[model samples]
Target: MDTPFEIFLSAPPGLEPLLLQEVTEAGFAAPEVAQGGVTIQGDWPDIWRANLTLRGASRVLVRFAQFRAFHLAQLDKRATKLDWGAVLPAGAECRVDVTCRNSKIYHDRAARARVAGAIESFGGKVSPEGSLRIMVRIEDDLVTFSMDTSGELLHRRGYKEATGKAPLRETLAALFLRQAGYAGDVPVVDPMCGSGTFVIEAARWAAGMAPGAERSFGFEALPSFDADAFAAMKAEAATRRDTDLRFYGSDRDDGAIRGAEANAARGHVADLCQFTRAAVSDLPRPEGRPGLVMVNPPYGARIGNRKLLFGLYGAFGAVLQERFHGWRLGMVTSDGGLAKATGLKLSAGPPVAFGGLTVKLYQAQL
Candidate 1:
């Protein structure tokens, strides 16, 4: 753990800047930005903080080792010679998740099989449904090994167990918040809030809370898992600052309200957010704050009827103009036509690649 290391935090495309900010804020002195991820030089403590505080990152990964190996024999010898027992427990359930990028080991499945076999022979057990995920990426013969510092990904922050047909991930929500510059001191609203993801993430961020405060990580069972240190760190993190603000969200469906309630309870922000069942035209118009109204309305793919969606967008536009006057608005959608339906003058920032679908979060003033 004392050696030089790099931590990679994967993010959606065009959200690298948000991830970079999170890495720097987590105490990385010099963070180098890469496509879909960020790299930092640090020790084990840095890795722990990255997992704990980085809300916008999908998962935190500690680069255990990275070296060049051009052939299978070289790869096998290096894998066998590496100190697998240091980070992974002996006989602990584990599996290899590999990715090959521009490397001689382009046969991803074969390389994964070889690596898994090597680890198994070295006393590492393969647990397909295990809690930990060990990621291996081979790029230009430089094989890199990293462990999933986050167990179920950062989006599964123990909240939002219930999901709609098309659900937005919590990490992506946080990144979108960063992109929108939400300060958490104002009133934020999310109409068409399926599962209440944006509002809940806003509540957690506004409370000055750690994203992983309620979850466990894979490194807890490793040899170097320092219980006392972790306890102290968590205790230090327990001091909460007061945030007297409201996060509002609404959805037309009743099940989304139930899921949002369960998620808020798990996230410890049930009291901070207001969830209701209403259409975009009937969304609550709170007074006295200049916060942004961010929404993730359904596209034609998820919800039925393309023509009605345009009418819904127009209603959304009218509501924002009449009810949420002088307040800024942000909308995330894959449909340019639907976005055009909302008559807010918006400047396009960047497109986020979310779950095989490319989305753009458009922001404008009412």
Candidate 2:
């Protein structure tokens, strides 16, 4: 527990740099962007804190050890020598997930069996259905051992049970918000607020609430977990600064509006967010200085006809350009034609994979 190890913050692909920026801002030690995530050098406390604080990360994986093994027998020998009891709780039920790439031990199932056997020999239980997860990557004859410190995806903030079709994930929404230059100091509006993800995330950010404040993590089950220390860390990170800004959302679907309101309440930001049932044409600018209008309007892949989507986007763009003067705009959609229909001079960010489709963030000042 005292030895420093690699703490990996898994992120959505193409958004690694944004997540890296977030991890750096959150004061993680030496955060370096990796292939599909960000890596920092830390120990057990740092691992716990990363799981607790990072918003853009999907999961936190702590790399415990790495060794070279050219064959299954060698891998099993090295695996059995690892001090699993120091990290994994005795009799802890764990599921081993193994991947092999360009390695002599190329059988994933064989490697999983070898590791599982080693864990069982150390008094740990390896089950198909287990709360704790152990991840193994055998690449180029080198085996890397890591653990999933986040059980459920971090996007499940224990709220937002109600969702509309093709809803944006909370983790992705937070990263998009950051990429769109949302500093939590200005008001945010989501014209098509499906389940109010963007609006609720903005409201929570403005309220200074930690993203993991209301959730528990998989690290709690580890042998090295210190409940008292983690509790103290959470207490010290607690912040709820009063802000004058407010968040607003409007959707044409009454059901979506209702769900958004419910999500807001569960997120503890109902008082700060105002959701109403309104079409894009009827979207209203809140009574205050102009702020950012963030939206994830319907794209061709999601719903509606292409022609109708163009019309809808054009109308939505006109509404923002005409009424919301001095306000900025951010939109997420998979179709460039629909984005062009909006008529806003939005520059596209890197393509982000979401729900089996690639979407880009388009942003500009209105």
Best by TM-score: 2
Candidate 1 stretches with Cα past 4 Å from truth are none
CA lDDT for candidate 2: 0.90
Listed in order, each prediction's TM-score against the native is 0.93, 0.97
Residue 341 alpha-carbon offset, candidate 2, angstroms: 0.7
Tens digits of lDDT, candidate 2, 149-183: 99999999877889998989999999999999998
> Which tens-of-lDDT digit does each residue in 189-217 have in candidate 1?
99887888899889888887788877778
Error of 1 at 321 (Å): 1.0
For candidate 1, the 10 contiguous residues with the lowest summed lDDT are 232-241
lDDT of each: 0.81, 0.90
How big is the positional error of residue 29 in model 2, measured in Å on the Cα after superposition? 0.6
